[model samples]
Target: MTVVTLARPDDADALSAFAETAFRHTFGHIYDPADLASFLTGWNPPDRIRAQLADPDWTIALVRGDGGAILGFVKLGPIDFDLPAGQPSEDATELHQLYVDHEAKGSGVAAALMEWGIAWARTRAAILYLSVFTENPRAQAFYRRYGFVDVGRNPFRVGNHIDEDRIWRLDL
Candidate 1:
């Protein structure tokens, strides 16, 4: 079984490296390699991830394989963290990012990360929410398996242009 732990600031480099590799595998085909590289570099660059790692409240949960390899991680925070103007009800948890190494795929790592996040959030309140790209139906379906229901839609800027995102929330 994989054990999930609270990630410390020092883990930023490893996390960023994982994001780079996993991101390339996940989206390189959908976009020009150059575009994907540029996008990923800018978004999850060492500097950026390091800054987030230093945040006082932002949380990152990481899971490691039995041999100690990183399998997956989930970034979560108060709804207000990612959404500047997002005013959720009293009980709302925002999922910022979730990714698992491809080799660890289909091993229930993602579900375990989500479960960790939801349980952690429940300690803070009663609802869990997340926003995912409108184009990624696979992820939408995956979220559904955890009982997350689509509730609304909005456009969020990625790189330059805005893209549609579906909001899903589960009542705790």
Candidate 2:
């Protein structure tokens, strides 16, 4: 069984470690090692995650399994990026990252995190949005199941490489 909880300040280290492992498990094969390393270093650093945990605008929720090990996490927050014209600029929230460990796949962790994120968004914004790599069809399909519709495309940067990512939005 797994339980979901808001990440605490002390969870910074564990969250950082789990995030790196989960990211590598999902996208390691898609990017060059150098690029992947650079992205991980900047994105999952313990200090960065710890700071985020302290930010009121961000919510970092974690899914813990047996022995209280983190199985997955979701980071949701107010929109900080520029949305294309026609996309509502106000009352927008972003599901910045949703990552699950490989072993936790098919165990309902992702679904739980997403459910919490959407519920949280309902109280905070009019719409919830997320960006998934264009090549990740499985993720796109999963988002579609939750009523997220494609709105546009955006450039996602991993280190110095730019990749196209499909933007999906769910109106709450």
Candidate 3:
């Protein structure tokens, strides 16, 4: 049976590699190879994952398969960008990243990770925030099922390309 649990420091390297693979599989075709490489190297390097693991504020969780291999992961933490004045609740945490192995699609791994992330946010924040690519209707629908509403728009850069993103918030 698959199980979701907190990620340990020793899992950083594996998580970094899994995240890179999952991300590339999900959105690699939509961007230039160079841009994808830039994003993978800059945003999800092993060092960054290690740092996040060591940070107390970041709650990183992984969904492991029956044999204990990681199938997916999620990270929840404080918002990284400046929020608009007087809009989002004061106690809000960001669902920074959620990635599931391509082979694990339709296995409920993503939903489990999201459930863990939402519960994590509930402990410290009243609202959960996330950003999804504007073009990704499937992901938007999934978030909507979890009560996330589009609150604004932002630009997410993949190398030199600026992709539009819809910011979503879920009130806990």
The candidate that achieves the highest lDDT relative to the unseen native structure: 2
Best by TM-score: 2
Residue-level lDDT of model 3, residues 81-150, one tens digit each, is 6555555657888999998888887889989999889988999999898989999887899899999998
What TM-score does candidate 3 get on C-alpha atoms?
A: 0.94
* Tens-place lDDT digits, model 1, residues 65-138: 87766789998776742432453656677887899998888888998898898888878768787888788887
Model 1: lDDT of residue 34: 58
Descending-TM-score candidate ranking: 2, 3, 1
Q: What lDDT score is found at residue 49 in candidate 2?
A: 82
Q: Cα deviation in Å at residue 162, candidate 1? A: 3.8
Which residue segments of model 1 deviate by more than 4 Å?
80-90
Better model by TM-score: candidate 1 vs candidate 3: 3
TM-score of each: 0.82, 0.95, 0.94
- Candidate 2 achieves a global lDDT of 0.88
Estimate the overall C-alpha local distance difference test score of candidate 1: 0.77
Backbone clashes in model 2, listed as residue pairs? none
RMSD of 3: 1.4
lDDT of 1 at 33: 55
